[model samples]
Target: MAKKVIETSKAVAIAAKLCRPSVIAAYPITPQTHIVERIADFVYDRDMDSEFLDVESEHSALSACLGAQAAGARTFTATASQGLALMHEILFVTSGMRLPVVMAIVNRALSAPINIWGDHSDSIASRDSGWMQFYVESAQEALDRIIMAYRIAENKDILLPAMVCLDGFTLSHVFEPVDIPEQKEVDKFLPSYSPLYRLDPKKPISMGPIGFPNSFMEFKYQQQEAMQKSISLIKKTHEEFSNIFNRSYGNGLIEEFMTKDADYAVMAMGTITATARHVVEELRKKGKKVGLIKVKTFRPFPEEDIIKAASKLKAIAVLDRDISFGQHGALFSDIRSALQNKDIIINNFIVGLGGRDVTSDHIKTAFDKTIKAKQTITEWLF
Candidate 1:
């Protein structure tokens, strides 16, 4: 293993390279372009041997990956904001078809005014698309999750697509010292893609055909079953990866920091969790009973883990980077559902929309409000 101070995009590209995907198709999008560019470097230098497709659009990129993965090849792709929105239709197709395609989402805000900056709107908007969503807080987690996404998604019981999301510009453009696992170690952890089923001419089987009314609901039911099954598979895969790599993130779902004895806590995902962690520490030093909950996996919701983490706390603040429009924050809604029957106060704070910086002061304010909140409070922290 080697540790290097490199851009988060570079770390993602290198991690994808180490996994040795046979096919890569991605369109250039702001912030996300760097990841594909670095992978192109690997293909150009012959450091990585893969079929790097120069696709025309984000839709085409994921389409190409879907075809490749369906034909028994491990595939990868990436995008952000509009690029992800463009691939919306295919996103459902890829997941519903049960292709284990992996994607990196440099999370960014969707357009109305055409702004391009960091936010969870892109991925959060696709929450119901049947893809296993993994959110990371740093370059290192981004690197590791890409490798783990493969094993978890490609599991025999869970042949579903997965996307690893990281905040754009915030974490993607920043440079940090990350430990890159050796290729052999990664290979040992993640063996080459041996799909149980494939689009082989010899087999000549049909897949993803139109589901009739008789079977449409059944197909949807199966997808839900696999999603539920994946919760355990994700945890197991995380444990196996940590055993070999000696690194982990709170059991590969939700990480609770300093929440053991705290009376109140802050809950959030992505890079903002880092700032929240700092604020929690500062509040701790001041003898405030506060903690932080960092969510690593968004999809499959981690409801039980969330409930367990929020238990015993007097009140909890849920910070979200995306709003559901006319409703509370996207994540806050989920948090409320998880703790709906509990006796604790749950407050929602929507911050960092459309790339606005989420400073520590903003996080401190969420904690301060949460600790003293008497009932459910929703506030915009812009």
Candidate 2:
């Protein structure tokens, strides 16, 4: 296996090649441009047997993907902030149809005033649209999660769309060394996709049609069951991926560092966890008991796992890069819910909004505050 320094765009392209999508419907946007561009180049060069549908807008891109997936073709697409907002309506439709479409969302700040920098607002806004969302902290995680997402989403028990997110310029444009597996290995890991139900003229079936009140609830109930069932499928996929790649993602719910005997823990998502881990190491060296928890999956919320990890600690600090507005951070509310009825002290800190820098010192500051507060606080605004 050879290693090469590659940009996030190339890494994603390589991953797509591994997944072997049959159809790619995408429109170009800044920060997200290279990913689709590289894939298009791959298609142009006949390196992969796939259709690259160049649509006029994000709406059309998703719409095309929906049709392709409905026709029993493995589908993929890429988008950013404004583009994602444009596809908001179709996003719900994809989930409602239960089409296992895998998309790469280069996390970007949404606009009242147009901006292209990274933020979670774009994807978080559509959290309720029935899509399984996974936030990646690095280029490697982004690549790995895409492969895992396809397997998870297409599982017979969980036929739902999935969004794999990476920060706009931070991980997307930054160059890093990545290990890309061989095509044969990827093929062995991810075989050709076979949809349970698809639109076919020979055996036609209607999809995404309006259901009356009589059966609407049943459809929704099944969707919920599928989502609930995804938890186990997610775990199974991680195990299989570990067996093939020789690297384990550690349960696919949360990754904990030095939490076994720690009294204080910091919780975060995406790349910010990397900084938190460094601060935790420093605190440990100073004889302070501290740990870090990185949340990889956000949609399912992983309530039980969160409770199990944070319950034993005296104090837990949640650092959210995203804001829910009028409430605490998004993860803050969920952590509180997970700790309900349990005797545990939790603090919520909202930082790194609009792509602000969240340094190790900031994490250390939060940890110090948590230790000093010592169960006398509920939430601290950082």
Candidate 3:
């Protein structure tokens, strides 16, 4: 293993390189472009041997990965806000075909106003796109999760695509000291892409065929069943990875920080979780019972783990960087669904949308409001 200070984007690129994907296809977009660029360097310098496709757009990028992955090759791609939005339809296609293609998402704000700053809106908007989403707070976690994502996504029980999300510019552009494990160790942890099935000329199998009404429901049902089964697979893979690499991210799901005995907790994803962690520490120093819950895995929602973590808390302040138009924040809605019929007060605090900075002060206010709230509340932290 070697430690080097590097940008999260480079860390992600190195991680993808270590995995030795057979095909790399991605179009350039801000924040996320660096990741693809670094990977291209690896391919061009012969440090990595892969079929690097210079795709025309984000849609082709994902579509190329889908084809490569279906053909029994390990595939990868990366994109930001509008790029991810463009790949929306194929996102379902990749997942529906049960191809285990992994993509790194540098989360940026969606268009309309056209902001390129960091936020969770991009990935959050794709929540139902059938990809397993893992958000990271730091470059190290970004590198580590990319490796782990491959293991989880390729698992026989969970042959689904995975998205490793890091805040654009926040984590993506920032530099940090990251310990990159040797490729040999990574190989041991992640053997290879032994696909359950592949498009072989010898076999001549029909793939992605039209699902008639009767077959269509079954196909989707199977996807849901696999998704539910992934919950345990994710935990097991996380444990195995931690044991092997001596690094982990809270059972590969919801990471609780000082929440066991707290009266109130701030639940958040991405870099904001880091901000909340510090605020939680400061609040504790001031004798306040505020803690933090860092959600590492957003998809397959970690509902049971979240419920268990919130059980002892009096209230929870769910800080969502993305808000559903004319409704509650996506994370808030899911948190409420998980804790339904419970007595604990859950407040939804919408913050950091369109790349607005979520400072420690914002987190502190959310915590204070959560503790003082008599009932569930929804407010924007502007």
Candidate 2 collision pairs: none
Find the candidate with the highest lDDT and give its number: 1
lDDT of 2 by residue, 171-278 (tens): 899899887888888888887999888888999888888899999999889988898888778878888998888766668878889999999899888888878888
Model 1, range 33-80, lDDT digits (tens) per residue? 999999999999999989999899999999999999989999999999
Better of 1 and 3 by lDDT: 1
Error of 1 at 86 (Å): 0.4
TM-score for all models, in order of appearance: 0.99, 0.96, 0.99
Q: What ranges in model 3 sit over 4 Å off?
A: none
Model 2, residue 36: displacement in angstroms? Answer: 0.7
User: How displaced is residue 212 in candidate 1, in Å?
Assistant: 0.5
Number of clashes found in candidate 1: 0
lDDT string for model 3 (1-382, tens) is 8999998899999999999999999999998999999999999999999989988999999999999998999999999999999999999999999999999999999988989998888999899989999999999999999999999999898899999999999889999999999989999999988997899999888889999997899999999999999999989989998998898889999898998689899898999988888898999999998888988899989999999999888899999999899999999999999999778899999999878889988988898888789998999999
